[model samples]
Target: MFSCYYCNFCKNRKTTGPFTQIPNPKSVLILPKKKKKNRAAHQYHLHLSSVAAGRQPSPLRRPLSPASSVIGAHHRCVPVKLLLPPSPAFTTVVAFSAPAFSRRGPTSFQISALKPEEEAASVAKAQKLRALQTQFFSFHHNKIYTKEAVELSAKLLEINPESYTPWNYRKLAVEHYLSQPDCNPDSIKSVLDDELRVVENALRQNFKSYGAWHHRKWVISKGHSSIDNELRLLDKFQKADSRNFHAWNYRRFVAESMKRSEQDELKYTEDMIYKNFSNYSAWHNRSVLLSALFEKKAEGFLSKEKVLPEEYEFIHQAIFTDPDDQSGWFYHLWLLDQTVTTDSPLLASSWPAHGYDVLLVEERCYNVTVECGFNKNEDLLWKPLSASNSQTARVWVAHLKIPSSDLHSTVEVSVGHSKGIISTRGFEYSHPSMFSFKVHVQPMERDFSQVSVAESISLREENFMIYGTQSEESIINSFNQLSIKNGHESTASNWRSEALAKEIECFRELKIGKLTLARLLMACDVMSYPFANKLVHSEEVLELYSDLMKLDPTHYQYYKDEHSMVLLQKVTSSKESLLQHCFQYKDSVSSAICGPICLRLNNLSLSRMGAFEKLLWVQMLDLSDNELQSIEGLEAMQLISCLSLRNNKLRSLTALEPLRKLKLLRVLDISYNEIGDHSIDTTRYLCSSPLSHSVGSESNKDETVTSDVALIDNWEAFYIFKDFNLNQLDIVGNTIADEKFKSVLVKIVPKLKQLDGKLLG
Candidate 1:
């Protein structure tokens, strides 16, 4: 019998022969040729037959089929109708011939039936895996930390390095073995070395395996592996994949353990960065090392005068090399944040213009002490007038004992460390009479001259290159005008401002890095010369963010939030606006009353509220219709009583923890927010009462009540409003506004007289 095979090249094909029974079909190698355009397609076939002892095959003849051809010796072409059969006992090679079949080549592959041996092996492996897992867990549960158990865990880990449970169990087994009474230093080293070798093998399978890396660190921590060997291993891993953060983190750990010099690490980062400027890890590491080196004043590093500029140049080179790379830009922003100074806490103003009985200091201070020169200089204790009664407050009040005779003399008042000379020469000399006076403390001017003249000139030259001489002069003139308007000296030689302006111009011209330009403008506006002046480019920053949203629509939400932050800063930076919006004055029968101010900051799209110290005196603040997700900065509004955070994105009542400090707060409106049940229930508060037990039957009742109180106190909202003295709270239009939640709220706030605009029964 002979087997016949057909090729797919023929449109319609038929073959007939007695198929030979082969022991194994998979042993046949079928090489398929790749199809090419405009090539002759041909299919080769192997023929087998059996003949009598002396029989000879027929001689070669002319092509029986017009399309068929014979190539090798002893080969013959037969007609398609011919059907040859092999003897049942013996098979012999007959000839190679072509037929109407499809073309195939070495590139093609065939899916054959799986052999019985392979299928059986797969099942056996699965069974072994199950058995190993069963034994491993048994050993773990039984606390069997023996050599056999350790070997079983090793076998399991070899199958899957990501199995963290096995890795942990193996560590425990090693530790147990080490703690044995028979174990010595040598034995301990040997065991640890074996563990390290196991971890090494696992890492070889997967260098990025978290479990393997963690185990390696544990073994190294046991003082088994040498630092040099570990470092070399890290070098190999990092070289293979430079952006592998796991390897980089492990390298950092090893370096710290070895107490490697920061300068050396910094050099390593530089080398990595030089090899691949797009590597974010290398750039981030470089930033960290550079900051540390600068702080320590490390030798062979750039001096303070050259540090920023040189680093900026390096970053610019990288950015210009690959305009799309974001690593350099991020590092640049980090450097700016580290170097630039913003609005730090300082004494801004004091009230009582001349001589008065009470002094009010408006500044963010942890402690304020007033020393008056009236009765031979005395340091009077100051108290925070803010309702929070916090030590660190924005408004501190102190009372002074004014002498009738000294009212017309020069008196000096010292607030904290800042001193103000109050001239009482023109005031009436009245005994025990209070008078209103105001003193404004000017923030010290930043000396731009500290920046070396040579550096300034170099920066200016670089600016001229980016923004041509004509444009550079225009920017300088514009900044100078802003400085003069804000009551600051000219920025003709302000190197920092000039450099920032130039960078902004370059980015604007290139029409790239919208975020980068916005940040640069913010830094320049905040850290401009004569730091006391108003922000120079806040409006520009806002507009740039708007452009960023349009340019990069994918990050529209982020840019919008940033825009809100900048707008908030701009509004708060102006003390005049803050006072106008927050303070309310009314005439009384006997005296003028100035308190319980109402600041309506509605519909500002504010995501974040900053400079809360400025709003410390505001009592009724409405921050409705904003994008505020959290109320973290509201803690400084210690005097706030009526606050409306309505129609915002607040997702939980726990975010209102900051409001708990407003001890005087009475009315709260948190309606139409994303507050949900999960957030409400998960909110926890620490128990304020100490754990104690009493004796007697009455004590049992008290203890039971105490336990119930403790359970209720676990909810943070209940704890926040326990002593709030709140008369009204509005939580309408929220997920947790159902009747059940209302009942829960009533329990949390017992003093509530009204709930969601209705009087509570």
Candidate 2:
């Protein structure tokens, strides 16, 4: 058995061992590079011969099979491992083969001459070539950077130094060979000198080769360049072609690498700027290059000449030239915002070393004061009006005369990044995007009246900052503190008081109906209680209620006998003594709520109550089509669950949370409300609990059991409504990816469902 090698080639495909054969062996060909190693080579051939016969492939000595003996031709077997048929590469090797041996080979497709004199002449030529190669290796490899190799390299350099192959080889000779075992540093310097000489020759040979310039880059990358030499060397290329971007690029790279970038980078940037202002790649690279120069020349360059970090003239020139390439303006805005921006000092401090005002202009229309966006949350800020202007939309900044040692002594403004925008005219201004101020305040949107009502939500001034819904932790403490100072809650309660007094008065007049105001006041009860426990204590409100009670017989009767109304029931049916009537009731209104002959508080304002008491209070009331703003009323309706607030101007799903706990109230029709995109997230919260959910959950369905089977299909899709068999799911949003994300989510919460409108069995 023989193991295969080289893609379907059997390695020892001849014989098992030397001097041994399988069924019967004949001849074998032995190839030995040196005549002294013929015996070992013979054994190798023998082993291969046996392996070819499929004999036991002995690891010690696998033999070759005789092709003639196996196929009955007695033809000599050849051992050349010609994986592919003869090609140009194989023919090249025939130049070195021995004539006698070469002529006897089977693959003799090239030559067959047997001339003795010619063979003698070939032998002489071979000897001379061998001597030359031996001399070359001895001097180059023996003395460890021997003077001879250096000398020869110098001569070679003079001839054709620009040839990359030799230059690379020269690099290897110096860097690799000189760094070996006992190689001397001084000798290595000589080799480097030789390398430089060779490079010079190559450049002088053909300065047009980009490879030569690139090679010089590699040399400089290793710190092998001198300012004088680099300048002098680069001049050669510049003299050849002035507009050569490659030469300029190389010059820029070298200037950056060296510590001597006084104004060279900016000089290059300015050059590129003036040559072609609209070249974005050159400008972008210039930004990177300038950072280094700015770091180097922070003192005189800025102080004496007032040289800015990013010059507007150079960058603006690009825009001025084309005024169309957005990238040019982008860089310009980047420059202005970047200069003078220091990190934010703790509280009160001057700005950093930068000295330019950057402005972010939105579509070139709205301008915001922003530094160059160099921070994470730059896009989210609006520029401060203090720093912005419409023309060129740059921040106004005067370079501060600050020192390095005293930099930390004074606090400074933080250099924040802004969203940059470019105009069709190629004028770039940064829009004060996300991170425009000390505190993030989202711009208010327009009002319903289409006014510029996008409120100026200065975080320092707003009432309450809503962090997140349900996640009270997200509400920043600052917002909470500000709320107290702003007096928002006090203002809200006052409105509730007014609405309450007005409703009671309307009942007395029997003119404005129940919608006058009493219902709204009752809904504002934070305790979720129906009415004031001791109404006699509170006066103006009580007077209004009394006046309404006296207006009509029906109104008087309902008020007199009412105690079980869901909104203000508190009806204590004790057999003590007291029989007081608040509203008029013509019949057993307590039982029928409102038996036609009796009246009902149908249009009650049940919003604003944030807590629920959990009881059947009222039903079949047309509370629908009212301006009940919030869902806060749903928390208190423990018993009075049948709600119909359809065809009204309600905008919140907030009241639904408390409603989820009510085990009673069933049919809810909140349709025709202006619940937009935000309503989706809000709705999911209200209907999440057991009673609030549309689905009838069973005891057996826990989180673990459903994680595997249904979740694979359920993850991308969420089941919102499941009444019996009618299931509606939403699966077409976000990146649900494969079922894996879904599988994991089901494990987190197995009861989540988002439904489309449907009536399930």
lDDT of each residue in 1-761, candidate 1, tens digit only: 00001011101111111111111111111123234434333342322111211112222111111121212122233332222222211112223232121111011222354699999998898899899999999999999988899988988888767678999998889878877899988888888888887887888776766788888888888875566788988888898888665687788889889999987898898889899987767877776677667756688554544676677778887877865554566666665654453212222322232223222211234543344565553665554432223444444444455455543444454433343311111111111211223333332232111222122111111121123344334333322322112222332235556666777887778666666777788777656323353667889989988876674443445566667767866776654444333422121011222223356677888776654433454556778888776565465455556778889877666557567556667778889988873433222221122221211211223433244554364454554455566777788999867887677778767777778777767
lDDT of 1: 0.54
* Model 2 quality (TM-score): 0.28
For all candidates in order, the CA lDDT equals 0.54, 0.34
Which one wins on TM-score? 1
Quality of model 2 by C-alpha lDDT:
0.34
Count of steric clashes across candidates, in order: 14, 94
Which portions of model 1 show Cα errors greater than 4 Å?
Answer: 1-127, 300-303, 341-499, 528-533, 579-591, 676-716, 759-761
Instruction: Score every model by TM-score.
Output: 0.62, 0.28
